[model samples]
Each structure stands twice: as C-alpha cells, then as structure tokens.
Target: MKFQAEACTTSVGGPRWERRLAIERRRAENHARRGRRTFRLSRIFSLKTAVKLFLKLSRLQARGEANARRPIIRRVSFSFPNLPTSFDGFRILHLSDFHFDGEAARAVMIRDMLRGVESDLCVLTGDYLADYFDPLGRVYCNLATVLSGVRAQYGTVGILGNNDHSEFVQRFSDLGVRMLVNDGFELGIKGESIWIAGVDDPNTFECEDVAGAMRGASSGAFKLLLAHSPEVAREAVEADVHLYVCGHTHGGQMCVPVLGPLFLNASCPRRFGSGAWRYKTMQGYTTTGLGTSAIPARFNCPPEAAIIELRRAR
Candidate 1:
C-alpha cells in the first residue's frame, strides 16, 4: 500500500499570527525600557532635590550660628514731659543678667561696654552668677573688680535674681553694690527727689511686696522700679510707678529667624518680648541681658547693655 502526499498551505493567517507575536514581543521590550528610563529620571530628580534641601539647611544653620555670636547693642532714650527741672536729663546705664561663672573674659567685655557709656546712674537688674557652683566664687571676684570700675555720678545700684543666693547678695554688698530687696530708697539730686525701688523675683522666691516696698516713698517723687521680671508691671503701675526696668526673659534667648523669640517664659504679653513697652501711664523696658543661660547660645537676640538717656520732654 502507498501513502498519498498531503499539501500544507502557509497562508495569510499564519504570517499574520507570527507578525502579531513579534509585535507583542517588541512592545513588551519597549515598555520595559521606558519603565527603566522613568525610574532613573525619578531617582536623579529626588537626589538633586535632597541635595539642594541639605545645602539650604546648612546655610540657614550657619547664619543662625553667626547671629548668635554677634553682639547687638540696643540704645533707648526716654523723656519725661513733667520731669523735674533738676532731674531733666538724667542718664542711666541699665545692665542685667550677667550670669557670670569664672569667665573673666565675659566680665572684661562687660566692663568695656560700661566704660564707654556716660551715665549718672548704673542699674544692675540681677542674676549675678549662673548657678550656686564653686566656680561662682571666681565669678563674683571678677564681677566685683568690674563693679569697682563702673563709674557713675550718683551710684551703682543692683538687685538679685532667682539664680542668686544669700551669699551672692552679701558679696555684692561688699563690692559697694547696694542690694535692694523689696525695699525703696530716695535719691536726692539737685534738690529733686527720685524714688528707686527694687522688688524680688516673683517667679522664683517670694520677697516681692511692691506696695509695701514703696509705702515709705514720697508720693510726689518720680518712681523708678527695678524688677527682675516684667510680670510685676501690673503691681508697679498700681503703685504709680513711672518707669519699670527688668531683664529675665533674655529676649526669648534663642529667637527664631522670622518667627522671633523661640520661647518666652514671661507672664507679660508676647509683644513685650525684649524692648520698650508702654501700658497706661507706666513704661516697661526689658533688656536682652548681658549673658547666656540654660543653653549658652542666642540667635537673633544678642546680649546687650542699654544706655537710656532720659531727656526732659518739651
């Protein structure tokens, strides 16, 4: 028996199926290539963005550190319209928050700052030493030397802060720095009388009785209240105080770039952060302070000693 030969047709359908398969393979390969390209571009963009952000952050940090190291001095002058003729232009050098701790360099810098100013009186607000450590002994000695060099026609008056202990107060007293703790004194200058009063820190220890402190003061005398914290401005105003000088918040210590003070523990309003403020008949001035505390750094808020030239208002 013989088998017959069968004819197979390679027609349009067969080639079309092969072409479709080839097209599908090429499409898949192209898709994969596009996906890899897209992934590579995304990675590059992310890396570039991250690098830019890191550089920006570095610059900002450098700027902040630079500002912290810079010392910015603020000068404020006030005029009392009804000031007595004899006390017309009495200038005062207000320095506060020394926070000294065996750092003779800081003390010398302070002395240099005060040496250039010409004032009738120098008022030291408080915080003579940073803490109750043994190093504070050296700090006190250096501070005493600096205090002895401070020149004022009237005198150098001071008060204590929360960080100060009884021993510190005694040391200050020995240095000819009069300690005014919840007490008032009268300064007679050219027949004109000015009541200088100091109140204890209201936040830390309890020694502030503003009313009682000013009870013995003459009613007609111009009242100048030296307080460590500005929170007592209400009591001072109630006692008819004309001027209030304080330095506790450290002008928020580390002020933010655009946001201002990072943190202010003050009881007063935020607007009174580190400058002169007026409320009713009372004028409150908060210094940026002379030294650092807590964190030994300051940003936009720099250490300062104020020269407040009081002029008679026309």
Candidate 2:
C-alpha cells in the first residue's frame, strides 16, 4: 500500500527520442486528418463562422466574449476514507485548456485572478495553443507569464491535449512543469504518498495509454488520473482510479440556457461532462477550462480555474 519512489520509471512516456518520433507521427496524422471528408466538409461549412455571425447579429457577441475573458474560481472539496491523514486538506490547483492565443489578456487575467491563492500541488490538463497551427513561441511565453504568478508547493504537472503538438512536452517541461505524457510518478507528503498517472490526448491524437501511465500504481492505492478529455473515464474506472480530472467539453462552451452545452465533443456521458460527478466508487471533475475554443466566446458557461481540496474522511 506504500508507493516507492524508485518504482516510477523515467524510461516510459515521451522521452527525447520518443518526442521526435511523436512529432513525425503527429504530423502524418494531421495530414491524414485534414484529408478526411468530414474534416473537409467541416471547413467548407464552418460552424464556428455561423456561431460567430449569430452572436454578432444578436449583439451578445460582446457579452459572450466578455464572459470568455472573465474567468472565475471554482472551489470543491472531497473526502476520502483511504486518504492519508497527513495529506488531509491537500489543495490542488487545477488549470486547463489555456487555448492561449497571441493576446496577453487571458494570461494577465489568470495571473491577477490567482494573486493570493496557494495550493499544495498544481495540475494542468492541455490544449495550450489557441490553434493547432499557431506557433509555440507566443503561447509558451504567455503560459510562463501566467505560471509565474501561481503558488504551488509541489510544483506543476501537465499532459497534452488534442490541439497540442508533441513538441509541447519538452517546451513546457523547460518551463518547470513536469510533463507527464503517457507517464506517471509518485508525489509524497509527510512520508505518505499517492500515484499520479497522466496520458496523452485521447480525443484527437488517440495516443493515450492509461495502463502505461498507471504502471507503478499499486492496486487499491490512491490513484489520480489526468487526461485532456474525459473520454477515458471508463478506462479510468476499470483501472481503479480514485479521481479523474479533465477539461475538454468546456461545459458546452456555449449553452442554450436550460438545455446546457450543445456539444460535449467528448464520448463520456452528459452527467460527467462538467463539474463533479461519480461513477461507481470513483469520483471525477471536468473543469470548464480557462479559455475558449472555436468561436472564442462563452455563453452561460464561463471560464474557470479549480481549487480542489482533498480531505481524509474519518
């Protein structure tokens, strides 16, 4: 029931050489994806364009755009019977889906929003770049500026999302955030520890390996899984994951009031699409994320950064 530091291997995940291969592999995949009829059709008949036009006509574009910029803090607490006593009240600052463009507004807003916040650990689920083809220089710099304001005792760990390229692993790692692409490790506090397993983008890239990420995690131990999208919820549950954290749906980025999100884009159930939900004995939370995609606006669902506190249930 104890996690050994040495049990975690540095060999797995995206190594330097693996990253190079991933770049080539992903390039090929992107090329193929672009040639698909669905992809071609979507481009020809753009939903993003239609949505933008509708917003502009209704005069809600400004409001939606403002909503996208105005992110809020979400706090939620969970109690676990098997959680280590020393780790009680452990706070995890979860930020996801930056979708950072050339604009500095979102980054500055995030920095200002997290001024006095503190946490034991920080986790980032991906989609860092605003567009798949956008250069990384601006995105990386803006992300660094935002991270500079964060105050996490144990530092940050992140995984890639559908929009991110393979090179982001090394680039972000250089920024001090441990990149966990199809890899995992143990985090300890006061002699007690837990396993954190992370996978690559399962939605677009389809390269996620949950089993590989959970390689060293022992059965019945406290296991936390990080994924770009919640599509892997079933696999996580089967792998005995305790908590699954993700952000891809964006809480239906643009909702229709009472109907909720128009599209989840993830394969998981609607119940697990946003906020917190339970499956069997496992608990999970899907963040609304920090930025908008497609249309770059939010309707009822505003952007968010989460403060998740873990308490020991006695």
lDDT of 2: 0.83
**Each model's RMSD to truth, in Å?**
31.3, 4.1
For 219-240, candidate 1 gives per-residue lDDT tens digits of 6778889998888888888999
Which candidate leads in lDDT? Answer: 2
TM-score of each: 0.76, 0.89
Residues 1-314 of candidate 2 have per-residue lDDT tens digits of 22122332234345533754676586769767874234456665776677788888999988888889889999999888988788889898999999988888779889989989998888999999887777678988888888888888888888889888777776777777777877888887788888988998888777788888898886667888999998988888888888999998898899887788877888889988899989888899999999888787898898999999998888
Cα distance off (Å), candidate 1, residue 246: 0.3
Clashing pairs in 1: none
Local distance difference test values of all predictions, in order? 0.71, 0.83
